[model samples]
Target: MFGGPYPWSLYCGQWSILPPAPKGNYLKDKVVVITGATSGVGLEASKQFADASPEQLIFAVRSVEAGEKLLGQIRKAHPNLQDKVMYLDLTDLQNIKDFSEAIKVFGRVDILINNAGINPNFDEGPYKSTKDGYERVFQTNVLSPFLTTLLLLPLLRKSSDPKVIFTGSDVHHIAPSDLIETALQNGQSIISAYNDEGKYHNPTRYYESKLLLQILSRNLIKTLPDITTINVNPGLAMTNLGRDFNLSLSPSGIVGILWFVANARSASKAARNLTSAAA
Candidate 1:
């Protein structure tokens, strides 16, 4: 749905949504850590994993309050699930490092889902850089995940069936070569290109980040043979990823919504795919 071809059934509206994750203790006693678990596909996937009975479900989030609220909701529904919150702001490299180090206390990490990301929308002005001096989209979507996955490798190795999951997009296929070449040649900085208002589109930057993520996942599997690394596109879903779009206030936004509804899957349906990948 995100700029790639898919079976017509996904866009047809008549196809039956996949049922909720199968009932079982598939993740029983396993330690699961998910970034961006406070909302959207991440939140839904957390619920599904909770139902599967993971021993520990830790959410590494930017907002502790939001994470606590989500944890409360999940606990209310599934009181027996063990879910906790840890602070992680991908915009800050130190926060990522601290979070990864804290994970060591858990002893083992059976599943790691790098599901957090951002799409600033077409209207958001000038490029923003992270505290680490990297472009915001590039750091949040690609570099942070790369670093987090690497830092957690030792913990992941402690588990019998360790798996790392990366949330990717079909939009990756459309990443412009000019941008890729520029970033590569200029030493990992896409800010110059992103700041060029005349040539930059928010979607393009987002797509490029996803493309980089897929590249990271592919290369990781070659070296880390003990852990299974998987990249998955959860299809286009109605989520807060488009919070910046302000669709209700503009004509183009309305058209965008209509197009999304026709082609996108719901967050719950997308979560099914994510949880299945983890299982």
Candidate 2:
């Protein structure tokens, strides 16, 4: 072991490794469905899957403009993916039903990425929405995904390797508990319970939602006993999430820093991982 024999630090790169999925070997033929695929991490995931050349690439987006814009980009870049677009408004229960029905035509949904979510009414919180009668955030971030997954079970179960991934955050791990039953009150949202702006505005509910995501993932893994469920955190990345934050970055820039130093790997990478997990 001569010290001069090797200069390890000379070319050291960030050490990141994805557990090899022996199943990842078979993605070219798999049909994948990605929710919230128009922008942010969802868009990145799509970019990655474009190369894998899956049999079909279905993008579920809230806005046609966003979906169409992403479609043009992906097509221009890959030119080989059999991509299709569908309208998906997670806040609307009917929309979920519609999207689910539309997806059944595929007959097989090997991978389901519950990545689309919204963080809003920060001044109030999800517990205060009348649309679906659910917290705006809870509906989009949690229940919508919940219902969508339930609806797709028939199709996903058809795949040899069916998996569902709920993108979670560290915040979820740090929320006050009891949120479990609160979020699942007869389909409609219950904002009346938490009225203190301080209580709801704090990261509690957001984290609670994520915490529930993990719990759901675990419960589903056991309840379904036929599918693998995983929750992943993308770490801090400079995503356009601030567009939703509504906070002024000019002051402390903590959000800006989090958005900066954390590194936002392209949306394609997120898509790729979902593809990789499915593969």
lDDT of candidates 1 onward, in order: 0.82, 0.67
What TM-score against the true fold does each predicted structure earn? 0.87, 0.78
Q: What's the C-alpha lDDT at position 52 in model 1?
A: 88
Worst 10 residues of 1 by lDDT: 1-10
Whole-model lDDT, candidate 1?
0.82
Please provide, for model 1 over 138-176, each residue's C-alpha lDDT reduced to its tens digit, 9 standing for 90 to 100. Answer: 889998999999899899999999999999976677676
User: What is candidate 2's TM-score against the reference?
Assistant: 0.78
Q: What lDDT is reached at residue 47 by model 2?
A: 69
How much does candidate 1 score in TM-score? 0.87
Which pairs of residues have clashing backbones in candidate 2? 23-279, 24-279, 44-267, 44-268, 45-267, 45-271, 126-135, 127-191, 133-189, 134-189
Maximum-lDDT candidate: 1
